[model samples]
Target: AADRVYLLAHGKVEKVGEGPYGAETVLEVLADGAYFGDQALVDGDATWSYTARAATACTVLVLTRQDVLNLAERAGSLRGHLDALASIPEQRTNKYGEAAIELSAGHVGEAVVPHTFVDYELSPREYELSVAQTVLKVHSRVADLY
Candidate 1:
């Protein structure tokens, strides 16, 4: 029944204690699939003294102490799913932003139109092209010119 605990997603450990610091075992390292505060649940204690950080991109399923006990008592499927989730990395949800294109009067005269893959002139050897699609997704903020 502590306030905080930590889990390990990879095989690494970090220790924090009193060498030159205030003087206390502030932290203890754990391995992948290790539990930190099981004694509090078994003995009805209330206090925690450790925190955890992701060693790599990990899928952390956080639950309150009560929820942890409930899930631990549930069917084995929940535990299996937790194990599976622990083995995977967190995915990035990319957020696209609005972009503008600026060209000189003689560059984008009035007769030419640009597509998603339009190539823009540069130097004699370096030219850039657009690879982004023109279609906007649902609720996407799009700004562009013809």
Candidate 2:
């Protein structure tokens, strides 16, 4: 369900979070063919939660959830977009391009850290803290790049 209503040309579009006489939520200036209302299609939910309109004349393409689902099967088409969009982070290979177990809970009596420790005691607090700290460090380092 990746289909979305989007502005396609030199036209202005608007989206309202609520009905008329309610708040006017203008769709931010989006590039031609860029997505709007993607969340509704992605979630496969019925009824658009927002109202969209083009302030100027422009061609608009409406894609259905079924259309996107079907497209994902074909290469060099919208299907690739769907596959990429729907893919989960875990399904993605690591930087080494490998499937790796990144986390584990000690309740399973397992040390989940990437590095193994000798002569280390597994206190509940320590285990949880270690995982959190590692995650924070990795995220911080990655975030810095952007």
Candidate 3:
């Protein structure tokens, strides 16, 4: 799926996710001028964990990953803001965005705890889809014969 950032320009949107027993839970209700998918700008391959549904008739401003990056390149403040948002996941959480816990189980007394750190993929795989079409010109006689 093509993930793009959405800015709520008008109306309302309900951000929802699957809850226990497969129930639909409302994560948040966004009003006009709210933005979702900021994380998409940072991680191109990241999949959305939640879904956004229209609460009412809405108008949204959409920005693709490339669009946001291009804007960030020309705007120094925006580039800094995006960088700060990108670093948040690495600073306090594991790759899964969960709290990092250090535990040593089944260890003998006086054994030093092994050091570990979260390692991220330097070059993650990115997939892009493209389409090609051919236009064929058939003669009137050829078309009738077929």
Candidate 4:
């Protein structure tokens, strides 16, 4: 999954893969702010189909396909984040003022184009598996496991 999608926090990582007939290729070298696995995540696949290695000492933040699904089912926290995104108003502006203008005319044979309204994209996608990660911010009994 590392190759499929990760956000680099520091240092660097490389994506290596094999082509037809066992030919190896360096697919990409990614640094900070680079991300992949979006295609797989959007398309509903959890299996990582590539190999990832550290080009240097590195740190990364990852979101696996299953974790994305869990975030959807357990989206109470994400709602606030999304709601904040929704409150912003979108408009079209132009030279005079507005980009979209209304027009109406009467004639022997006049063709009218009706306006269709579209809504914002804020729906959750369905997934088959589940995933989660926990960052321990305390020195407690669970520290023993580490």
The lDDT of each candidate is 0.48, 0.54, 0.80, 0.63
**lDDT by residue for model 4 (9-86), tens:** 888888788755678877778887767565544454345656778899988888765776567568875656545544
lDDT of 1 by residue, 56-113 (tens): 4554434455675577568587667555645554333323222433322333435443
Highest lDDT: give the candidate number.
Answer: 3
The candidates, ranked best first by lDDT, are 3, 4, 2, 1
Model 3 CA deviation exceeding 4 Å by range: 90-146
lDDT of 3 at 71: 95
How many times do residue backbones clash in model 3?
A: 0
**Candidate 3 or 2, higher TM-score:** 3
Candidate 2, position 13, lDDT: 65
- Per-candidate TM-score against the hidden true structure: 0.31, 0.41, 0.58, 0.41
Residue pairs of candidate 4 with colliding backbone atoms:
4-37
For model 3, residues 27-121, the per-residue Cα lDDT tens digits are: 78999888898778887787888889999999999999998899999999999988887777555666445567575544345445567676676
RMSD (CA, Å), each prediction: 20.1, 14.9, 23.6, 22.3
Model 2 segments more than 4 A misplaced = 1-7, 18-22, 76-84, 87-146
What pairs collide in candidate 2?
A: 71-79, 72-79
Candidate 1 vs 4: which has more TM-score = 4
